[model samples]
Target chain A: MAAAAAERERVPFTFSAAGLDHPHIHSMVQGLLDAGAQLMHIYDENPDQANALRAKFQTGQVVQELSAILHSEVDLVATSIVPSKRGALGVQVLEHDKHFLSAKAPFTTMAQLHAAEDAVRRSGKKWAVFYSERLAVEAALLADGIVQEGLIGELFQLTGSGPHRLQAETRPAWFFDPGKNGGILCDIGSHQIEQLLHYARCKDAKVLHSKVANYAHPQYGDWQDFGDATLVTDTGVSQYFRVDWFTPEGLRVWGDGRTVLHGTNGFVELRKYTDVARSAVGDHLYVVTDEEEIYFPAKGKVGIPYFRQLIDDCVLGTETAMSQEHTFRAAALAIQAQEQAISLTKAGERR
Target chain B: MAAAAAERERVPFTFSAAGLDHPHIHSMVQGLLDAGAQLMHIYDENPDQANALRAKFQTGQVVQELSAILHSEVDLVATSIVPSKRGALGVQVLEHDKHFLSAKAPFTTMAQLHAAEDAVRRSGKKWAVFYSERLAVEAALLADGIVQEGLIGELFQLTGSGPHRLQAETRPAWFFDPGKNGGILCDIGSHQIEQLLHYARCKDAKVLHSKVANYAHPQYGDWQDFGDATLVTDTGVSQYFRVDWFTPEGLRVWGDGRTVLHGTNGFVELRKYTDVARSAVGDHLYVVTDEEEIYFPAKGKVGIPYFRQLIDDCVLGTETAMSQEHTFRAAALAIQAQEQAISLTKAGERR
Candidate 1:
């Protein structure tokens, strides 16, 4: 606990958390400030919360006003704000961070994961990142590990799919909103697709076909949580993958969560618990050969512990475990896979 | 001189220089008899030579006479007869050898070259081979020596060029006839092609493209003595080769008067000289690498060379250094390359 506090105090600068009502945002902001960051700006469209926070800050000798923090011209900034229905705090944080973090933001448009990469390159600073869970950057990292080792000789194919039932949950309406990255295939399948392309060492890939569906529990009219896709490479290798939110517990959860790699000499399978509460006890990596099978253990957390490693590498000027380019490629493939699934499904309907 | 005489006495064979009057038939007949075999029949409108030879043998002598060698009831056969023209000996010899050596032959074709192999397969019985040029075969044996030692990586590509400029000679008009294997590509290139494919592991190849020209000494009647061809494999590796009978030297040769093998890691170049009246020297094998070139010293006057080796192998149960399948593939490729060249040359004229 003391070490965590000391680390928090070392942050040196921060941003406002007034408009951020989410628990996650509150925790992140408080952690940054307590780690030696100075909160520079704060605003809340919610006047009551803003006024209450403002009064509390005035009363506390250690807490300063937002204006005073900004006038200090600190070296770094951070923020977590809850956007209204008409606004998006994520995009605002990206823009403000760009200027505050040496005139460069490491996060930008949600559609282009490489936007942050470009920002880092322009800023000329060692960088680290945090993004939506939908990105599944950790999977991409695993793919990188396989390719760099030349474990499978050469990666030749990639395919993936998603579940169809979850989109029907109407209570979380934004879950069906494509604008906010809610399509099941794009949101989840993108992670796998990106990793496949990176591992295959493919510079560019053409999508052969994709199909998406919304079946079962159709309360969410516009969302699709189930999809399948196929891709063929110029070198003649083909890949097929599927995704669905609805699966029978006994049948669906078998064989390492069904992620498999077919290689010239052998294969590898991955399994991770979908439920965070139970994942820590269940995650595994299975490496199989014609002769035998070996398993490696993995534990799950709310966020990747690996991200802290990346930050450490940046601070210490050490080599990064993965390339940012691979990350970009993975992100792009995911998006492409989703788009292809949408197009193919529409074509199938026409037929 | 003593060894030649002793070989003649032990072989129970007789040579008639008059057979050379029809060089093609003479070679075919000679090859068959040298391997200790005889044709069951002979067919000719004149039958003068056949009758004369038949009369020379006593009633109990091991000899048979028939109307046509092709239709003979004999287990094996040989022919040097030419139905149409006087100097059509090369192709006649080739045709007869091919016919008898094919699976349809009642008796296997043989020669000192295949004597040992035949003995091993036939068990103590002499197989018939009806060809001369024991020295040429010897040169082939020498070339095979380098390849077997892994001087190059697995033999991947083999090619042969020409005994060019044949048509310029005032005598031997038949030397230009395509039907008689008169051209340099067929007569000399055949040998090299066989050797190259013999070394290379390739089982089959198709001609991708070719170009041919009768640039010099058109007196041979638009006969092509210069050509180049390319072959592409199903595996995506491509080989380009050139053959020219009209090179600047009085007689220029590539490969071992017959063939050369290009390996994955290195190259082997063999050159054969069959100018019998001359010192018969110029036999060379060069193993080349990016760093240095090594030349194996020529083996001088290796006795009873290729044909003798084949005979020894047949008799002794030894594996033939060069495979028959390799020879077949090389022959097929050579034929395809020739046809492609002709087609391309014609196409070029129209353009």
Candidate 2:
């Protein structure tokens, strides 16, 4: 471990997978460290991994151990364990379940999620989500690009959707329980909600309408599938979104997935489709003017690699990174939509 | 006049004007007829002008003489004219006002001016307005071009402003009476209101807010000199208009002077500034687009000459030249705004 740390430092960074418990997190940390990350503070609450690492490392030489990883002094923090539930009481536990199920999960509720967010805010640091990293990057890029490039003339509408499918083989049984914020709406819808608000450039948005349903993975015996929502802003722009657990074509992820913006001079449409089952993809963004249509391919490095970008942005003081405050708004919107969808379902049932 | 009518009749169409007792009504009728229109019917309580025409020609012609004027059969309907301090009452009177105003003063109100708009269903006729004869031609050309080109997009916002300055020496005293619907906000504002509603393509638009004030032209004595009004539609579009009796330049006899439209992709601004003070100089229109601006010389036409176009479209069973429903909607919006302005003024005074 000491020799590995020395070798990593020689190249400019050290990767100590001391705190992270997930294999993906460990691999990502190793890749960044190998590519020249100066320091990495991987953390998890599991003591067995910490003790195992201590046995393999020299005392006061490599892989420093900390009592609590998040509370420790670290230049950057990356976590994939955000709780999926977003409301009061049982929400935090449900979110934790979702985090375990989804590989890298977002903080469950806004309040608990605010710990890392507040840290970023107080320290003026940048952070990124690891699981839905492409979306995180897309949200940041589109928000900045629209304002910078004057694309889409004026954003009129934004829509997003996520997978409603949940695997029964996933060990976390609490993942399917709504009481623990285990529903697909709260888990995946949160990401979309955040992205929509971000792209719309809205300061404060209120949910205009929403709908949610449970369709697939009935064995989980919970409402974790088929959620759709829409919102309108004070500026007259509208946003719509949907998330389904039982999509037959595997996981499809898109940034600026399906967007239509009507401007004074013309319009723009951005459509992205990814077939996770085949690992195949197709995407296109077209801006239609009065006389012509301009198209651009959306191709980039995929996944939560944006986490590294967030870390780099924080360390380097770059203006391009997405802020926690920005993500929080999306989170809030998602939670609001989820609650609204449930209310709508109840109202519809009543009618 | 007979010779001219005979010469015109040799062709497929003819136009002629007959005198009426009241200058206002005569001016209105003659204006329509002189524009190459065939008068189908005439109904007036005052038969003096008709009698004088008959005696002058020794034709024994009267209001009933209109039957002879029409080569084909004509429809003649007569109703008693009642002078009420409260102005014309009932939906029929308002509906008539709309038709007459559109035909005689296309820049004025449409049939929807009646308070009973709720009872009238849209018949989908094109109702075009022209502040002056020159503008009428240009607008006619544009409408024809749009129709020929099928350049149809959703109309967004339309705005217009006509001169407020009325010639006191030539104007009747009743023209200044607000109770008789003679105020600038009603007369001129009505034209703008109609234009806006048509441009915005809104239906059943309720006035959300309005402000009206008389700020200039104190010298007009009994008549208010200036009127400024603003209205917001339920769909979120806003409109503002101002009318002044004194535009440092001389009185404008034709065209409301300026109009503008803002669409999704671009904007169109039309301005007609006549050397009204100079030797009966003709007015000209300037159209500005996002890419370029051009001026079109107005031949001596002053109103929407599209009555023929409307008639032709009706005969051909095609879409009307303009949207009558939109015209009525605009008029309704203007009236509602005017009422709101009055209410606001009262509220302000109480404060």
Chain B TM per candidate, please?
0.57, 0.60
Per-model C-alpha lDDT, please?
A: 0.40, 0.42
Provide C-alpha RMSD values for all models, in order.
22.5, 16.1
lDDT of 2 by residue, A1-351 (tens): 345345434544322343334334444444344445644343445665545434433221223344333333434333333244222212222222211112233445456556545444454534344434334334334433643465434444454544332444643545556655534555667666665555566666767555554322345554544555656554544455555543222123321133334332334444445312222354444444434445555555333345445445544555343554566566666666666654212211211
Q: Which candidate should be chosen as best, given lDDT against the real structure? A: 2
Q: Can you give the lDDT of residue A345 in candidate 2? A: 22
Runs in model 1 lying further than 4 Å from the true structure: A1-153, A158-171, A201-204, A231-239, A247-257, A274-280, A300-305, A313-324, A342-351, B1-351
Model 2 interface DockQ: 0.02
Clashes of 2: 39
Q: Report the CAPRI category for model 2.
A: incorrect
Question: Residue by residue across A32-122, what tens digits does model 1's lDDT show?
Answer: 4444455555555555555555454542122334444334434333333321221233233334432222111122234344445555466
Candidate 2: residue B34 lDDT (0-100): 52
> Stretches of candidate 2 above 4 Å error?
A1-35, A38-74, A82-105, A114-127, A130-148, A163-165, A216-222, A233-236, A249-264, A275-279, A300-308, A317-319, A343-351, B1-351
Worst 10 residues of 2 chain B by lDDT: B75-84
* Candidate 1 residue-wise lDDT, B174-283, digit = tens: 44565544343434444444433444445665565455544333455545555555453433223434455522222222111434454434455555552212223556
